[model samples]
Target: MNSASDLGALAHPAATPAALPTFDDVLAAAARIAPHAHSTPVLRSRTLDALAGCELHFKAEHLQRAGAFKFRGACNAVWSLPDATAARGVVTHSSGNHGAALALAARTRGIPCHVVVPHNAVAAKMAAIRAYGATLHHCEPTIAAREAACAAVQAQTGAELVHPYTDARVIAGQGTAALELLGHDGRFDALVTPLGGGGLLSGTAITAAAVSPATRVFGAEPAGAADGFASLQRGERVLELAPDTVCDGLRGLLGAPNFALLRAHRVEVLLADDAATVQALRLFWQRAKQLIEPSSAIALAVVLANRERFAGQRVGIVLSGGNVDLDALAGLFASA
Candidate 1:
C-alpha cells in the first residue's frame, strides 16, 4: 500500500484540497479533547483472533463516553467553538449516536443543543439524546427532512451547525481514536472501522496515512446500506438512498468531504450482510464479552467473510458503539 506521503500515486491531484484536515489537525484535536474524550483501550481477543485467523486488536470505543466513538468528534466540535459562538449553542441532525454524542458534548460545555432526529430513530438512542438535555426535533425519516429541520433550528436559535461527519473539526476529532489506537498498540497491517457517513473511516485513513504509513485502511459497510461502496465504485458521491439495514447508524449517505478523503487515501470498503453482521455481533458478545451494536460488528463480519485477505495479519478493528435497543434485541438476533 502507498503511504499517505505518496498521495500523488493514489489521489487525483485536484480532488484533495488544502482545506481538508491533515495530521496536524488530528494532533490539535487530540490535545483539545484530551480532558473530555477517553483514550479508549486497544483490546486483544485471542479467541477472536483464532476464529478470524488474524491477530485482532479491537479499539474499544464502545466503552467511550456516551457509549460510542461519536463522542470524540462531537466533543471536539462542541469545544472548538469560541466562547461567543458556543454561547449561541450547537445543532445537528442524527439518527441516534451522533445526536446523543453532540447532546452530551454540549452539556459538557454548558451550552444548549438541538438535535433533529428522524421519527424512525431507535427509542433507546432518542432517550439518550433527551437525557443529555438537548431539545429534540422530529422529522420524517429522510435526509431532506432532517436537513430542513436542522436548518429551521439553526435559523431559530442561531446555533452553530456541527455536521455529524462532514465538518473538518469533527473529522479531525474522529481521527484521534486511531491516533490513540496506533500510538498504544503500534503498527498494524490493516485497520477497519464501521462506515456510516464516513467520519470514522476518513479519520482512520488519515491517521493511518500519517502515522502508520504502510497500514491499509478499510471501511466495513452493510450490504443493505452499501452507499459507501457504491460511491467509491462510481467515483462520485451518491446523494440519495433509501437504506434498508438493521444497522441504523450505518444508514446515512456518505458526506462529500468524507468521500473525497476516502478516495484520496485509497481507502477500500468491504460489505457484510445483515445475517453475517448479527452473527458477528453474537460472537463478539459470547467471546469478547463486548456488547457492540451491529454497525460496529460489521467490521468483524467483513474480516470473517474475507478470511484469506486478513489471515495472519495484524488487523485493528474499531468497535464503534454499544448502544443496542434492548427491546429489539430478540427480533434482531432471531433474524440471524
Candidate 2:
C-alpha cells in the first residue's frame, strides 16, 4: 500500500519537468480538435458562489460527448493518425470515459477500436464503449498489469496505440477546454481542474498560460491518491496508490509529459479527502443542479476549503465528467 505521505519519495525513472509546449502548440491543438468536439457551455452558480466565497464559472465538460472532456483528446488522437495507421484501428487502456470516447471517435473515422479495460471498471462506461462498437479486452486492476495487457493487445492487433494521456496530440486536444473557457470569458483569476492523469489540467495550464497568462492554474487530487501533489513538491513524478479512492476517474498517476507541463507552469496541486469530495459532489447536485463525477467535485472542494485563495475572485473550473452509475449514486447520496 502506498501511503499518501510516501508518494513524494517514490521516484519515477524518467520523470523530468522540461519541454513545456508553447502557445502555438495549444493553438494547433485547438484547430485539430475543433472539428470533432463541441464548444461546451460555461455555467455559473449563484449558490456555489455563496458557499465558496468566489464567483465560480464552470466549463461543463460533463455534458460533452461520451460524458467527459476525454472525448476531445481521444478524437484528436484518432483523427491525427495516418489512413494506413488508422486502418488497423486504434487501441488504448482505459477504465471508462477514454475507452468510450475513443470507441466513438474511431467509429466516426471508420476504423476499429480496441480498449483494454479493467475488470472492475464502471459498468455504465463499459456499456458505452460497447455501444460505440469497440472490442473490449479485460485486464487486472493494477496500472502495470493494464499497461502490459495493452502492449499485448497492440502486438496482436497491429493497432496504433493512442495513450489516454501521455501523448502530445492528446494533451493538445485536452487543452481545448481551457481555450474555450478563456475565449468565452477571460475574467477568471484562476482555473482549477481535477488532477486525474493530469490530462485536462496540464492542457488547462498550457492554454491558460497562453491566452490568460494572468490566470493561475491549479490541480485538485484525492488526498488518498495525492501522487501529483507529492511529485510537485519533490520536483519529480510519482505514482499513485493503486486502486484507492471512490473517484475512480482520477485514480491514474500523473503522466510524465503532464507532470513536466504542470511543473513548468508552476501549477498548484491540492488534495481533498474522499469525504470532502463526496460532500462537494452532493452539493453540486443539490445546489447547482449539475450532475458530475466525484473527480469533478474536487475542484469545488478546493475552492470551498481554501476560501481565502479564491474569495471574491472569478475562478474557472472544469466539470470533467458525469458518467457515474445510477445505483452507485443512490448508494453514495442516500438518506443518512
Candidate 3:
C-alpha cells in the first residue's frame, strides 16, 4: 500500500480561498496556455445521448496532448515559472498523465523536466514521459513514499515543483477544459467528470459557475477508492487511499485546496465500483465507439444510472484520458 507521504501533497496556507480560479483566473490561464495546447474535439453520440436521456457533449480530452487533458495544466505551470526558476527546470510526481504532460510541455519551452513516478506506473505513460525529455525518478508505490521522494528530489535538484492537481496555477489551467466546453457550446445544464485529486473537478466547478451558474458540477469516483465522495460527505478533507482499482489514475485523494474548492462549489460526488466502470466502458466501446479509461467511464456510468437527474437536459462531460493498456482490456470484457 502506498502511504499518504509517498504522494506529494500541495502546501496550502491557512488563508487560501476555497472558492478559487475565479473566471478571471481561468481566462488568464486559457490565454497563457492557448498557444501551446489543442482545442480537443467534442464528440457526440446520438445513441448514447438517447440512452442517457441527455444531450451528451463529450469533450474528448483524451485526444489532447500526451493523451490526456493534463497538458493544459502542465503547460500553464511551466510557462508561469520565471526564467531563473525555469532554468533549474520543473519537477512533479505523477502516476502517468501529468508526468507526460509536464514532460511534453517542458520540452516545448526548452526546459528540463523531472518526474517522480511509481515503479508500478503504466509502461507506456512512463515511456511517453521519457520520450518527451523528462528525467525519471522511480519511487515507492505509497502516496507517502512518493511525497518523501519528491521532497528529496526538489531539494537535491532545485527544480521548481508542479504538483499534479493541487496548485492554484494548475487548477486554473485545468479550468480551461470547462472554458473550452462552455465556449464551444454554453448550453450544458450540468458538467460531470471523474475526480481523483480534484484537478478536473475543481476546474469544472470554476468553469460551470462562471459560464452557467445554474449548471451543477458533479464528479464520479470508484467505490473502492471513493475518498472524494467520503470526504465530501464528511465535510472534511480525506487524504488517505490505497491504490486498488482498475481506475489506477483515480487512486489518489483530493488535495487540500481542491477539497476546499469542491466544498465552496458544493459539488456532488457519486460512487461507482470497478464492475460498473467496466460495464460502462464496454457500453461506450460498443455504442459510442469510443475508447476510454475506467476513470472516464465512471462519469459515463453516473449519467447512465442517474437518468432522471440529467433527463431532458444537455450535459457536458470531459473524457479525461485514454492511455489504457490494450492487453489488460481483454480481461475487462472477458466476463461480460
* Ranked by lDDT, top first: 1, 3, 2
Residue-level lDDT tens digits of model 3 in 1-336? 223322443322223434456778888899999889999989998989878888999999888888888898999889899999998899988756788899999998999998888787667767878899899998877657777888888898899988788778888999999999989987778899998888889988988887888988999888878888988899987655555567767877787788888999999998877787888888888987777877788899888988999999999989998877786767666633
- Output the worst ten-in-a-row residue range by lDDT, candidate 1: 1-10
TM-score for candidate 1 = 0.92
Using lDDT, give the best candidate's number.
Answer: 1
lDDT of 2 by residue, 271-336 (tens): 888788888998899987888988798888888999998889989999999887777766565421
> lDDT, candidate 1, residue 90?
99
Q: Per-candidate TM vs. native?
A: 0.92, 0.90, 0.91
lDDT of 1 by residue, 126-235 (tens): 78899999998988765566667878988988999887788889899999999998999998999999997888999999999999989999999989778899999999
Q: Order the candidate numbers by TM-score, best to worst.
A: 1, 3, 2
**Candidate 1 vs 3: which has more lDDT:** 1
The residue pairs found clashing in candidate 1 are none
